[model samples]
Target: MFEELRIPTLWITKVRGENTVEPTRLAPLMQYIVDKTDKDTAVIIEGIEYLILENGFETVFKFLTNLKDNLLAKMRC
Candidate 1:
């Protein structure tokens, strides 16, 4: 979907394939992208229900909160 829209995306999955990030390692992957990209970059996280089903609500929530905080901090800098 994103490809057809011309939006580049990094796929996060547990399939252990090339260029794919495992769901458990989402934080580091997201942090890496956040660090590398400019402030104008917009991260669209789909499949929240899937993530929650795989990792539980608390874990996903904390991950999202941390990501948001990190992005906000980066923007402030």
Candidate 2:
């Protein structure tokens, strides 16, 4: 899954089980998040706000830019 798609930082929902989401890593949009998972502390990443909370590097206005850049980079191959 990581080697297939092109979206970086594949959001993982640890509520249900391990690796519940697909496309683990876009492999193009700068796949980040080395140690996001916290067994002791869980963070729910959802809605538009979650994007900012989880990925503070992106701002509301800059979100589109980041999204486009990442997506484009992932599909470049």
Candidate 3:
């Protein structure tokens, strides 16, 4: 649905439930989505380090960054 719906979405897979995704796997997934689309996406994340990522997420928030960067670059120069 996400590939065509154009809305940002996430699919959760369980560990020991046929497939297991590490909680840490989420980081690169988030980065990949950002790189692929411009829309804001929310993930229903549950992890031990979840609370610690609030500030860190922003540092890697480059999804649709070209749009942001382009606009900022124009405004600055």
**Which candidate wins on TM-score?**
1
The segments of candidate 1 whose C-alpha lies over 4 angstroms from its true place after superposition are: 1-8
Candidate 3 lDDT, 1-77, residue by residue in tens: 65597654443343433224333455555455445443343434444244235335543344234445544454454
Which residue segments of model 3 deviate by more than 4 Å? 1-4, 15-21, 39-77
Q: Rank the candidates by TM-score, best first.
A: 1, 2, 3
Candidate 1 local lDDT, residue 68: 86
Q: Whole-model lDDT, candidate 3?
A: 0.44
Which tens-of-lDDT digit does each residue in 1-77 have in candidate 1?
76798766766788877667777786767676676566878887878887788789999998888888888888899
**Backbone clash tally (model 2):** 1
Q: Global lDDT for candidate 2?
A: 0.41
Better of 2 and 3 by lDDT: 3
TM-score of each: 0.78, 0.29, 0.28
**Considering lDDT, where higher is better, how would the candidates rank from best to worst?**
1, 3, 2
Comparing candidate 1 with candidate 3, which one achieves the higher TM-score? 1
Residue 16 lDDT in model 1? Answer: 78
Give the alpha carbon lDDT tens digit for every residue of 1-55 in model 2: 6347533334444354434442222222223432332223222334545444555
Instruction: Say which candidate scores most in lDDT.
Output: 1
Worst 10 residues of 3 by lDDT: 14-23
Please report the TM-score between candidate 2 and the true structure.
0.29
